[model samples]
Every structure is written in structure tokens, then in C-alpha cells.
Target: MMAPRNIAPIGYSGGSAPRSGPSGTLGADNRLTTYANTTRRRVDTILELFFADKARRADSDRLPPDIVGALHAHIFAGGSRTRATLCALGWQSNGGQERLPGAVLRAAASLELHHAGVVAYNDLIENQEPRRGIVPLRRMMEFRYVSESLGKQSAGLLGLLTLAWSDELFHGARLTARQRCAAIPVLAEMRADVIYGQLLALTGMDCDLGDVDLALRIVRYKTVGYRYEHPLQLGASLAGANPDIRRTLSAYARPLGEASQLCADLRSVFGNPLTREQPRPEDLQRSRTTVLFNIAAAVADADQRAELLTLTANPDLDATGAQRCREIIETTGAAAETVRMVAQRRALALQALEATPIPMPAAEMLRVLARRVTANIPSSCCLGRGTS
Candidate 1:
């Protein structure tokens, strides 16, 4: 595939151009940043309007005020906003105008609500104590419940309600019949992929640690389909993209999404202070089988494999144990291998992008995003990096 054309390097400072590099892709970063910021602002506005509508009805609704408040808080809590951003990018890349139509913005923002519902449900399943840097929604609702059972049920109900609200917001968009028809199937596929991925993960939770294929299958369905492919296709569908364009976008999205998830996995275990705050390595503590862990186990010597098995056997690994597990992973070169996989997938994604006939701006934006997502993995998480 030929290299991307018409790219300009971004200048970090104001009013002065940096010396052009061999690629001359400097100003593209500035453009991508502005585009991302605009998408975020539009999505935020949609969310505000949604919350306003809810507030107007809250006074008369039978639900308690605190429940509504908690829901609002959960929505407002910070996140990467990746799905909505991708939706807007996909739409714009597929021939949507610079000034996004209200319907498009509404459709894109609805993905955020759908994500909120998924996270809320995920928290319940994982029995997580915190979500989006705050107390889990269930715990927030616990005080309002008459009993623990009632609280749990209410939390689940809240998640379902969010999903309903997502559908409501989506339909509220003034999409044409064709757009609706195109978009609905993509949305359905996204939801089903996530549900299936979750089921697979849950079922495989206690399976053998050596099952790398199963682990990666979970990543493909859970991360690639839900987070990347579906959202991109939804945006493209909204823009009335043809089947061929949608198919081409998926060709780019699949590897990009997997690379994105692998970067996330590395960051979660190593550390990424850039995108979001790092959390405790939940995969280790929960003994969840991930591609990284499986890779390490597969390559480990007999004693190292035994060590991994011992560490993962604990449901609540302490900080020291988590550190030891990280050491084992690094020592075994799994960390480096994971980083290498990210680079390989990223290269494949770029190659796919080069082969596609998408608009230059969209293709460039995606290339920039691919670099951004995978940028710091090797530097921050490599074996000799001293574990942050």
C-alpha cells in the first residue's frame, strides 16, 4: 500500500511552524486535536440536553430523586469517550459535513449512554467497588434500598433503564428511514457482541490459563467489535455509507481495535498516566485470564509457570503479589511480546487504511489516533522501564 498523502506535521507551539520532517505530517495533529475537541463538545451538549430532559421529568416521576442524581453523576463521570468520538469520526470520514447535523450528534451521543449501561452492568458482574473513579452505581443506590436485595435489583434496573434511554435517544434523532435501517442492525450487532463476549469471558474465567486463543477471542468480540467496529460502522451507516465502505472501515477497525485493547492491557498492568488514571491490575487480582497473562504463562519456564499459577490462584492478590506477577510477566518477555503485537497490529491497520478509498482527512485522523493509542506502550511498560 502507498503511504498516506497530503499529511502535515503538527506544531506543538503557537505561531511558529516546526521544521518539517521527512513525512511532513505536522499540522495534521492540530487538525485532529481540533476535530476531537469539537466532537467532544457536541457530544457533551447532547448529554446535557438529555440530562435536562430527565431533570424536567424527575419531579413528577415515581423514582426517588437520589436515584436520578446518581444516574446523572455516573454519566458525567469522566471517560475516554472513545465510542462517541469514533462514531463522529466515522460519520465525518464517510462524507458527513463539518457542521454535524443534530440527529447525527444525538445518535453519536447515545452510544455513550449505551456504554454507561454496559459499564454499570459490568460493575455489578465484577462486583467492583468503584467505577469511573467513583463508588459503583450499586453502592450509590444501596442506601436508598430497603434491603440489600432490593438495592441490587435497583442497580440492575438502573442499568436496564440506561439501555432503554440509549434506545430512546437514538430514535429521537431525526434519521431517515434508510439511515435507521442501516444503523439499527449495527447497533444490534454491537450489543450482541458485547453480551456474547461477556458470557465467553465469564465461562472461561476458570478455564485453563494456557488458553490463549480463548483469551484473544474474548478480546476480539469484547474489545474489537463493541468498542471499535460497531461504533465506526454505526457512524458510517448514519452517513449512508455503502456496504463496501462499511466493509472497508471494518478491515481497518479490527486490527486497530485489537491493538488499542492490547495497549490498554499493558497500561492497566504497567501504568498509563496519560489517557486515564491507572487502576490496580484487576485481571491479576480477579485471576482473570487475559492475553498478556496467558502469553507469559505460555512462555514461562516450569518454575515461572508455577509462580504464575500460584499468584493467579489468589482471588485478592495484594499489592506485593501484584508486583511480583508483573515482574514475572516482564521477566518472561510477555510484556515485550505484547508491545510487539501492538506494533504489528498497528502496522496491519495502517496497511489496510492505505488500501481503502476513504477520504484523506478520515484516514489521516485514524492514523493519528492509532499512533496516539499505541504511542507510549513500549516506553512505559518495557521490561527495563523499572515498572513506573
Candidate 2:
């Protein structure tokens, strides 16, 4: 077996809160501001224009405007636009140059649309109410159709429709047939990987929470491959990046992705003041079956385990119960253990990034992004180490 690279993590400071994009939205990067070549706002604007045009076309064809409108709402509701930006960054970093082609930008736009579709499907599968706690789509559908079953079926179809819209954008981009053909395999693989990972998670939803290994496997496909690796590969492929650069990117992408997902899981449970992500009750109450839960269960004493089971199983788990759950997670050192895992993965990503021979602005921008993953990890998490 090949040994892991022993690169020291240099040139990496913890990420600062990224400045707002042109429309004053926070996302996955700061370079989107400093680097004029591409921005999240730029990508978002492209998506907005496409969706607007799509709505117009749908209206003209006597299609359901509400469906199109709802799809539009879900897409813009909230997201960091991480994949789209990564695609853009990959293009610029690999000699696609300052003026990105319209085709490349549109290709990047497809990633967000496709991601939105996937998220909608996840919302259905998880069946949890939205974090905002009201779902207008389902409510509107139930009111119109008069059947909850019809409403749910409509939402599922809508999710699938979003994916078709993604394909519409991809096919609509003015790339040569050859370029489209070349990029197909990457997108195809991304779709398959994410689906498989999501299915794995769905099958494991029985409060088993199995172990770190199972949850990490889900992260690898569901988050890492879907979010990081494929998007970058698509962009690099569009830019005609050489094999060597792709290899270096692969090295950096995996660990960065894993660390990013781990940190996000941490934020969702532990509360991130910077991101304003409070501890979500549904996340704990609904048998989330996540890595942190597994770690806690794996290490908890008999009493702690019983309390955790009761809290997680409670249909009416309140803030008080959720706090107790956090306490159990903390005392068992699961949060800290996950934190250490994140630090290691993050360091490996940075080390690989430092050695990558990409151009100056792009390389530096990636370093900034690498730090952003751990930016919101509370200082208190650092103290949770070894409490067990």
C-alpha cells in the first residue's frame, strides 16, 4: 500500500468570515470578491437569467407557471453555490484565462440547478419540515390538489423536473458537441455517486447510527465527490487542464471535501454563531444517524446511551432535550473526536494544496477556501478533546 504524503500544512490560517458577494450574500469563498475573474454573484446571476428565461418559455407553452415558480423559489432559497464556483475556479486556475466563455459559465450554472434538484429530493426523503419550519410548496399543492398524497407526489416530480432543467441548461450551453460529449462522463459519475451515497444513508436511517466508518462513506459520495471532485474535474476538463494538474487537484479535493462535510455536520449540531446555524432539533429528534451520533453511541456509557436513545427517539424532543443530547455528545468526546478528524483532513488538504503548481491567484484562492471549512468551528470544540 502506498503511504500517505507527509506534507506539513503551511500557508493555512483559519478562514475568516468571507465578505458578502455583490448582492450581499455569503458563500463558500472570499476570493470570489478579491479575484475579479469570477464571483458567486456572477454564477448566481447566470442561474437567475436562465431560470427567468425558462419561466417565460414555460408560460408560452401553456405549462404550469406555479411549478416553474416553485422550482425557482427552491433554487434561490439558500445555498453557498460551492459547486458552481468550484467549476469556475477550476477553469480559471487551469489557464481558461480571465474572460471565461459563456459556455463554461452556463455549464457551471447547471451544477447548481442539478444540486437544487437533488436537495429537493432529499427534503422529501428526510420528510422533515424545512428549517424555516413551513413548506409553501407542499402547502400550496395540498390546497390545490386536496390530497396530501398528490402534494407529495407533485413535490417529487418537481424535484425530478429540476434535474431535467439541469440537463436543459447543459444541453443549451453553446459548447461544441465534442466538448459536451467529453464532459458527460464526469456529470454522469457525479449523479450516480450522489444517488448511491444517498441511498446508503436512506437504508441506514433506522437509528442504528452504526459507526464513523459508515457515516464517512456516505460523506465521501454524498458530499465530497458530489460537491468537490466532480465539479472541479468538469471545470478543468473544460479548460483543457493536463493530467498532472488533475492528479494534484484530486489529491487536494478529497480531503478538502471530507473536512468540509465534517465541519458542516459539526456546525449543524453544535451551532455556528458565525453562520448563525443554531442546533437543529429535527436533526437530533429524527434519528439523523450521522457520524457524530455514531461516535457518541460507540463511546457512551450505559446511562448516557440510554438517555441518548430516549432523546433521539422522542417525537417531541424540545430544546431542553436537544441540549441534553449535546451534553451527551460532548461528554463522550464525539464532537472533539470529529473535530480532530476534521483538523487532520484539513491539514492534508492544505499540504497538498501548498505543493500544487497551479497559477498564483488560483492557488492562493484555494488556500483561502480550504481555511473557510473550519472557520465556524467553535473554540469550545477544541476543549472537548479527551473528556471521556
Candidate 3:
């Protein structure tokens, strides 16, 4: 495999405290506080709108009876809402009105639905046993009233259909026909690219390492571009962001997305400050090709590094094995290195925001808010609930 790229981490240098808000009181940073509060409110509204009874009214007619049960179960079940949060914040930053058009709201909620669908499929493939603190997908379907195969099939198909619905929702926007048409291809491309990233991570193919260029390409393609930039772009698209503003968001999203994903990488491997429920951080067990993983594996001594590799490569390793691997990684100091990297990425994200024309105070507030999310792993935020 080619060596991995070395982009900076996405978080601050401070310890795993998830509540690292700005030093000043909420009084001083009220604009940021307001923005965050508004963002959270909007995120909630978006979810309610998307999953509301009205949202489900069309389902029975739209989906076959066999799959509707599974589809309804996953959609109504609470989920990360990360993409919706991203879109809401991005829309606000782009000057979207207090009551964003229904189209934009639909788009934002659909982004989350697609994300959930992806997770459901991923769990099935990876044989993961838990999601949002619930029993595994297999158990959810089969253990209660049906067979495991029926449950698996239901979970898998529901996820797939939800993904398709996410696309249709985007296409159904109220924007000008021309604008909507233009946005569809861009959104579709971003959605497809995320799946590609998942495939690359799952298959463990040999990737090129010598080219620093490839690393950015991988990160941009697999991580940054899809995670933040695209969602921001979609929000920008909704608000009709000018070319310049769009370009600026593109630049800003890279570091922010990297930091966010890096934090996830940390939780997956070292420990999640946001939600500590993972039996094991999925990244290490899966040997995800995160930038931090590349650095840690490369930097460790031969014996330790080999041990890390061996542990991850074992497909049969269960939760017990995941715990053992976490021990190996911690002993090798890889966990600390991962923390350091998150700090670096956080800095990069802030720097990108600084260079943009966004008002300095507002930009600072956004940075602080980003920090808040990063800091709140396993503690304030359970994978299933609000931030700690």
C-alpha cells in the first residue's frame, strides 16, 4: 500500500474535555451562543420535519409492505444528525433565513437519512453488534419475532431504500429547475464518493504512498470533501452562495472535516469522548487508513507495529480481541499521538476560517462551537443522545 497523507488533525491540543468553550462567559460570546443555539434548534426542527408523521405518511404507498417495517424502525430511531447539524450551520453561515425553505430543510434531513442508511449497511457488512446503543441490526430484526436472515434482509434493504429516498429528496427541492438540476449532480457525486471511501476502507486495498499528492486526494476524496465541504456546499447551494463564498467554504471545510473525522478516529481507537459506547473503536478493529493510523503504524517499532497490524488483520477478532488491540495501541503511545494529531487538525480548521472573509468574531464563535463538538466525545454525547 502507498504511504498515507499527513494532513494536520482536526481538534485542539487540550485534553479530552468536550466542553472547551471559549474562555469568556456566554455573555461575551452570545453571538456564537446564539448561532449555536439557533443551529441546534434548526437541526432539531429539520429532524422533526423529516421524520414527522407527515414525513412517514408517504412511506406506506412508496415502499413495499415487507420493507416498510424495517424502514420505519430505522428512520424513527434517533441517529447522529451530524449532517443535518452541518447543513443547518452552513446555511446560517451562508445567510439562510431563520425559516429556511422547506426544500432546504428536506435536503438537510435527507442528508442525515442517507448517513443512517450507510451506517446500517456498514454494520451488517462489518458484523458490528451495536448502533445508537441498541442491539445490533441483526438482532433488531431477527431476535424478537423473525429469523436472523429476515432481519438482516430487512435492515439491509431499508438502508438501501433510504439512501435512494435521500437522493430524491434532494432532487425535489423548490429551487429553479436549472439550479436544482445543477445541484443534483454535485450532491449525487458527493454521496457516491462517500460510499467509495467506505469501500476503500473496508477492502484494505494497497494504496499509493509515495505521492504526497495522493494523500490529499485520498483525504479530500475520502474524508474532507465528502464530510464537510460537500454538505456546506449543498447548504451554500440552497442559500445561493456566490462563487467566491463557495470557494472559501471549500477551503474551510477541509480542516474542519478532517478534525471531525479525526476525532471520530480517536474515539474509534483510543476512546471516544463524545460517546463511549463502542465495544471497541471501529477504526482500529477495521484498521481504517486514517492519517493518524498511518503515522502511528509507521512510527512504532517493528515488533509493536507488527503486533498492531496482526491484531487488526484478524477478521475473526471479536469484542474481546478489540479490547486486546486497544491495549496494544495504548502501550505503544499511539493513542497520545492520535490526540496530538487531532490538535493539529483543529488548528488547521481554525486557520482556514481565519483566512476567510467571515467576520472575525463570528468566525471565532464557529471555531469554539466546533471545539465543543470535538471535546464532547463519550462524555456529553452518547452515540445515542445529546452531547455530554
Candidate 4:
């Protein structure tokens, strides 16, 4: 399964095209904004073509129209376009190309299809709602089927179908046979990584939330690998990047990806609960055992520790209990500590970009992405992919 939403999908876009190289003078903010907007538009264009082809293949006698419609709605609903943007950046890294080639864009688009399939599946697995922090895919299906069970079942089926379509898109991306050979292995690894990450996530559900390493591992497997590392590596591989550049990209992605999750976790607990499309705060509800909680657990007195145990993972927790958990987190300095960690990771990611021989433009764009993901979570939980 794959997802921009299920991954640490970013949110925000606006800009115009302007060619620039690693040492180019284009403004970082404007370039990144353009990159984000351009990537989204190109991906949407590819998706539109895909749907048109599907329409041609599926006449009245063929596939039911509703499932495809539902998927269309879910994907177009909008996400951060994180993976796709990262792909574009990777292909262009180290002064590979200025204008993005059509094949490269299609390959980038393939990542989205893959992301959609996995994210759709993730919706079923996570079981938190409103789906994908916006439109609810399963609920939409329920409306079409007029049966809750049927609708949920249809979503799962759609997930499988979308995954198949993702493969189709990948193979159809028009990569040269040489490019295909370079990319296929990474694609295979990405598929395995996402599944393995999800398995880790599902398994970690009832386990101790206090294991900081376990939680970070989940973030790495679920998010860092396929979402950041693989997407970057895949794009770089497609462009025939050397191993050193790929290594640099990996070093940049790992800490930044974890920091992104940390930002989401902070937003989930402390950010406003009334944001549009926001679901019930799942972090405390599910006992996710984020770094914030672990830090509190380590420092708390017995009474405070007992309170955290009672408050988190409590299906029956009320406002009062929730407030108590927040208080413990606040008083024990866990929230502040987590904030510090975000800054720390951000610094590390930036350092990785600087330490390597990456082109300046590529490094700047990657920095722009890092800053976006690790930006201060405001009082509202506007960020998506909530706490795992």
C-alpha cells in the first residue's frame, strides 16, 4: 500500500516556473512553491489521463463505475504532494536536469498512484476517521452501496484495485529499458517496506508506548523508508545518480521524516480539535506512545505515571481525564522536550544536506521541504497523517 496522505504528505502550494541550477539564484521560497504547485498539476494531469483511459476500457458492459469514481474523489481530494515533490527534486538533484522530462514526471506520478493505493488501504487499517483527515472514502462507498458493511468492503477492494493500477502506471511511465532496470528493484523494495511498516504499526498498537525506539522505528519504516528515502532514491536511481547522492538523500530523509511525525503528534494532542476534517485525537485515544509521552513517563513521579497509564488508551476518557494527561505532559516538560527534538532533527537534516556535495538548489529545495514539515504546529491541528 502507498499514500501521500498515509505518508507525511505536505500541505501548501503556489509558484511559477523558473529554471535554476544547484548554484542558481532563484529564491528558495519561490522555487519551492513553484515546485510544489508544478508537481501537483503534473500529477493531476497524469491521473486525468489515466481515468480517461479507464473510461475508454470500461464501457457499460465492463467495470462498475462507482468504485473508480470513489477513488477519483479520494485522490483528488488533495494532499501534501510530499512524495511526488521529493521525486522531482531527486531527479533534478546534482544538476541532473533543469526542465523535468515527461518520463520523470510520469515516474513521479507513479509514486502518487502507489501512495493512493497504500493510503486507501491504510484508511481501513487505521480505522480512524474522518478518513484521510478530509473526505471519508469508506463513508463515500457506504453512500454508494447504501450499506455500511458493503461500503467498507468496497473500500478494501478499491485499495487492491488501485494498487494494481499503480503498477500499471509505473510500467507505463515510459522509462527507458535502462531506467526501468535501475528503478524496478527500488520499486520492489518500496512495496515491501510499506507493508512491513504497516505490520509494525499494527503490532505496536497494544505494546508499550513508552519505548521511544520502537515508536521512532515505526515512523522510519512506515514513513521514512518509502515516503522519503525510497521516493528520493527511486527518482535518483531513475536519473542514474551515483550512490553518494543517494546516500545523502537517505541521511536527509530519516531524521526529517521522524520530525514530521513528531510535529503531527504535537498538533494532535495540543492543537485545536475543531479544524475542518479533523478526527478525534487518536494519539491519546490509541496510546501511540510518542516521544512526548515517553519523556513524561521517564520523568514523572509514580502518581503522574499512573495518571498517564489511565488517561491514554482509555476509550472512556472524558474531557477532564484528557486535560489531566495534558497537564502531566506540560508540567513534566515533555511537550517542551518534544519541541526541542523537532528542532534537533531539523538541524540534523539540514546538516546532512550541507555535509554532502549536493547542488545548492537541490539542497535548498529539500531544506524548504524540511522547514515546511517541521514548521511550528499552531493551536489548530491542521496537519494531516495524525500521530502514526
Q: Tell me how candidate 3 scores on lDDT.
A: 0.59
- Positional deviation of residue 351's Cα in model 4 after best superposition, in angstroms: 1.1
| Candidate 4, run of 10 with poorest lDDT | 7-16
lDDT of 2: 0.74
Q: Which candidate is the best by lDDT?
A: 1
The lowest-lDDT stretch of 10 consecutive residues in candidate 2 is: 1-10
Candidate number with the higher lDDT (1 or 2): 1
Error of 3 at 247 (Å): 1.7
lDDT per residue as tens, model 2, 1-388: 1112221121122233445554322432444444422445566677778777877888677768777767777777655567877887788668777556889888988998889878877777777565543364555456668898897788788778888989999888998776787689889999999999888888877636537788888888887887888888888888888888877777888998988877777776777756455777887754356777888888888899889988888888899999899888888898898888888887888788666588866676676777766656766666665434
Candidate 4, 1-388: lDDT as tens digits: 1224322224322122334544443477577866677677777788888886776666763787655667877776667567888888888785677557888888888888788878877777766466344666777888888998898898888888888888888888778998999998988998888888888878877676567777777778777777888888888898899888888898998898888878777766675222432224454665464666776777777898887887776777777777677777777776777777788898999898876687777778898778767765544323222231
lDDT of 1 by residue, 1-388 (tens): 1112222222111122323554536566566667766676677777877777787788787666667678887776655467887887789767788667889889988998999898887777777776334677777777676566777778889999999999999999999999999999999999999888878877887787768789899889876897888888999998988777787789888988888878777766776544344447565654356788788777788999998788767777777888888888888888888888888898988887766578888888788777766665635456532211
The reply for model 3, stretches above 4 Å from the true place, is: 1-66, 136-138, 144-150, 205-223, 273-283, 315-324, 331-333, 359-365, 376-388
If candidate 4 were superposed on the true structure by all CA atoms, what would the RMSD be?
5.7
Q: What are the root-mean-square deviations of the candidates from the true structure over C-alphas?
A: 6.7, 7.7, 8.5, 5.7
lDDT of 1 at 76: 68
Per-candidate local distance difference test: 0.76, 0.74, 0.59, 0.73
**TM-score of model 4 relative to the true fold?**
0.86
CA lDDT for candidate 4:
0.73
